[model samples]
Target: MNEAIERSNPEFPPKIINGCVWKLREKSPGMVNKPSRGVFQLLKYRN
Candidate 1:
């Protein structure tokens, strides 16, 4: 789990360095901040 996530997005692991392996990419907020209407409600809160 650790190795897979690290290679996909190298900058990811450090953001949640203290977190566990179960945390999904979508569950990790702030990683992506693209504004939209359907999914990614957090985008509206950004900027």
Candidate 2:
């Protein structure tokens, strides 16, 4: 994820990946093991 973000814009680094889910269950769809960062979050970027 960091690699992709870096490739997108090296100079402009407003976007960042805070947390991620390691795995998920097959029974539950669209559901992660636990809460993840950057999800359902909206914040203003500072200069």
Candidate 3:
């Protein structure tokens, strides 16, 4: 995850994924995940 973020934006710091909240270094970027159903929902929402 960190690698991917870094690839896109090297300035992006490491982020910790805990449920819906995501912590990036010293900053909290708010909710990173959303409620979903099964594989169809997952495929429907691809970032």
Window of ten residues with lowest summed lDDT in model 1: 32-41
Clashing pairs in 2: none
lDDT tens digits by residue: candidate 3, 1-47? 43555677766444532322233322432423334421112224457
lDDT of 1: 0.51
Q: RMSD for each model, in Å, please? A: 8.6, 11.6, 8.3
Per-residue CA lDDT of model 2 for 1-47, tens digit only, reads 45665678687443433222222223344442323542321223211
Give the Cα error of residue 17 in candidate 1, in Å. 5.6
Q: After TM-score superposition, what is the CA distance of residue 21 in candidate 3 from its true location, in Å?
A: 7.5
Report, for every candidate in turn, its global Cα lDDT versus the true structure: 0.51, 0.38, 0.38
Each candidate's TM vs. the true structure?
Answer: 0.31, 0.26, 0.28
Give the best candidate by lDDT.
1
- What is the alpha-carbon RMSD of candidate 3 to the true structure? 8.3
**Residue 10 CA displacement from its true place in model 1, Å:** 0.5
List model 1 lDDT by residue over 1-47, tens digit each: 45666788788755574265334335766564435432333454667
